[model samples]
Target: MSGRDFTERDIHMALDGELPGEDRAGYEAWLAANPDMQARRTRYAGDAEALRSAFAGVLDEPVPARLTRAALGEKPVVVERRRPRWWLAAAAALLLAVGGAGGYVAASLGGGSHDDSAQDQLAEEAIAAHVVYAAEKRHAVEVPASDLDHMETWLSNRIGMKLVAPNLSDDGFQLVGGRLLPAGGHRAAMLLYEDAEGNRISLFVTTEPAAHGKGIYAQSGEGPRAVYWLDKGYGCAVVGSLPDNRLSEVAKRAYEQLIAGMIS
Candidate 1:
């Protein structure tokens, strides 16, 4: 098949070794001649690596008998039994990966359950918000970066949490500005950052308490995917319509910068 006819899923499957042998060879050849596709594959590979680093431990840890039974499509007698060691280990792992020590500690102490569906919904909302605002010509942000100090304080106060714009220049994206958005009962801070090509990614943050019952989840739709985690008493959803790998890279960088700012 011609390169023009190949779908993104075909390319992703080929990179993931999920394609049939005959189709794999065709895609490999196509990728070899197509630099853009090759680049996308490289980015996806990096994202896969980052995700494995972040969550593979959870898979290897002996799932609690209850969790294992649930995964096997069996009903557990009691799903609410406390497993402090397992919870602590999971929180510690997440803290190491995201540098949200305070957030993790709060979550652990609160005995709350993390909700996967809620996190997914947050990501979807973030993407919808991106699509709505990225197309704006003059009113993308309520407060532009020109008034950086005021913008930061205004958003922090509005969200009831400190807000800082993560520097994304090393990744070819810079802060454009930000706006305040209402998300359910809590306020959401949407920081808009842009690359040289004018492509934009948004970081959606709110002070909603971490849902402790559900585990971390990664999902993608359209051109963007959301990477979400609970950090320091806040729920963070980093959303972008970029390739999966690029979005993960941006999230990783943003996590590091935001955590550093929070601690320092």
Candidate 2:
């Protein structure tokens, strides 16, 4: 009935509504008395909800034959990336939605589909980051925009590029800040922005060679809609819940500013 009596598993159980009824009151009381623990619980609950809301329909979608074959240890059909390939996005979604089993299948299908898989991962990571951080109130970013120069420099050095937070006031989104994240074996930088209505958008950038793709590609139906592209050795995606046209416009402006900055 006290903090000392509870374990980490208890916190997860409480958050998942799986705790015993007799212990619920004690857990709630303990959480109220521990603000830090309460904050952690809130963040975890938010992340879980975000992931659920983002991929709730993944289970209902029919599995692609290629993925199924790959899962069964058969070589997957190599698909060309002419247009925006949705199946790879779906595969990434499945990997996130189903956990270990999906991971095994993804590992099985990895080597042969390097390029499309890499792009899929970028889209997945971008959307996943947006879903997790955009919903946060207190910890939306690692660095605040007030220290824009410092943030840019720090991210640039970490991500191995001259990272610049694109100006998007014209799109009604002001720079909130940015954060550094791990992207497979590489480093990634993500800048967060929010409009007057408090709607947030995130731009995810990485230096992965495979992330270099043909043109601006749209990834949807997994989480939020994202416009991903590769330019100047940097792969980037602008992710938000905005309409397709609006998201594309913001992404285009961002891409232009980013490219111009690199050139200058």
Candidate 3:
């Protein structure tokens, strides 16, 4: 065992098979000392394989005319960018190993640059997911709170990070459950919590690679109020139907726990 502390991002890289061989050995040793992490790794490995198998067909499809034309500079066409989003959803729903898990479509649009791309894409998908799932009463989540352990593992595998649902009871929201959603070239894990009054909140998390964001970015749109923050190379957003004050407090608490839980 290396006896070194590994950050959540390190775990993600390991899961995605992006870790250097030396680092991969060390991470495996770390998982040996941590049984929970070992189990998480096993589950994640399966999830990754399943995702690849599910989307294997897309690789065989002929390139779309617009993409081909744009590549050759033959046409000035602005594609809607919605096609790939649904393919992601289709893969998630067809997760045979994790049967009956529904997924939400997430489209990644153009951001400022490579630095801002991941953050902006994650934020837009987070809000879009919250808008879609928060309205569901019967099927609010794919894996309910009862299966939170598995949900965490599933999401970690898909998103290439380790995770725990941050406690929100202190913030007046009880854990409802969470689902793994599609995020363009990435993936997202959405945790849904509900207040006693039935208001729902979502915490969206994914690894924010490349450029780190500044401070928290807060905004409100037609659907939900949201506060997004990047900490320790992870991108997270707190979104809810509550007012700015309530959402801000919730975001603060989530941020603290997220920071505290960073592997190193």
Candidate 4:
């Protein structure tokens, strides 16, 4: 099959190793020829690996006696071979059942860390996106800022929230462009900006809520600093290599505009 014959679904299936054997080679060649798609596939693979890593302990632990009894229910259950995604979903559900409400309650009750894993995942994704795309000079974003309207519409539709690239001219950064990204289990929109000095910042947005105790939190100690915040419609993290103060300024501007967009 020609490159044009491969649809978005086919690419994802290929990434998941679910594509038919006959069509896999053609899609593989297509992905090899397309750097952007190849990058996307890499991101998806990374996400899958991260998921596996997060629950690695579960694989070693024996199933709880009560859970086994509840599932068996006096009848033998035959386990069927399933896709990796299905296994990941099943593992996640099992984990929640084992850990309970993402360990918040268990942690609180046990006097352990009360950090929100979902918000941490969001920040991790945002930083990862920035590290991968911000360094690119030619293909930083899938859509250029010159086509702002289309970029806005496409990302908004895919991410399930009306998205507008926040104005940051006051902070000396201009919109460079934006792109769609796989953010764990959520579809994410990333808006890239550049300053006169050639420094870049990316605002990663997702419809999934990422609120924790801190309304807006700044991540410290890393290659890049990130400021994450939650909105009624979506959550966003502004990531850049700039100083903490500078990054916070950019994040504040983005937060105001995003909140205003939701209000109006």
Cα lDDT tens digits for candidate 1, 28-96:
787788899888988998998898899978878875565566578874342233333554465345434
The lDDT per prediction is 0.68, 0.75, 0.68, 0.71
- Cα lDDT tens digits, model 3, 1-264, are 355677656767887778877676788777788888777778878999899999999999998665676578773332233324543343233232222221111112223233444444566778888989999999989999988789878887887887878888897888899888756545678999998999998999877655455222223324675567554557888887675556666777877776665553
* Backbone clashes in model 4, listed as residue pairs: none
Using Cα atoms with residue i matched to residue i, what is each candidate's TM-score against the true structure? 0.54, 0.57, 0.55, 0.55
- Listed per candidate, the RMSD to the true structure in angstroms reads 19.0, 15.7, 20.1, 18.0
What's model 4's lDDT at 62?
88
TM-score of 2: 0.57
Residue-by-residue lDDT tens digits, candidate 2, 1-264:
533466567789987889988888788888788888888899999999999989989999998675676578874343443435566565455444433321222332345434665666677788888989999998999999999999989999999988889999999999999999876556799999999999999999888653445223345444586667654567888898886557767887887788777667
Rank candidates by TM-score, best first.
Answer: 2, 4, 3, 1
Give the clashing pairs for model 2: none
Q: Please give the range of 10 consecutive residues that has the lowest summed lDDT in model 3.
A: 100-109
The top-ranked prediction according to TM-score is 2
Count the clashes in each prediction: 10, 0, 1, 0
- Number of the top lDDT candidate: 2
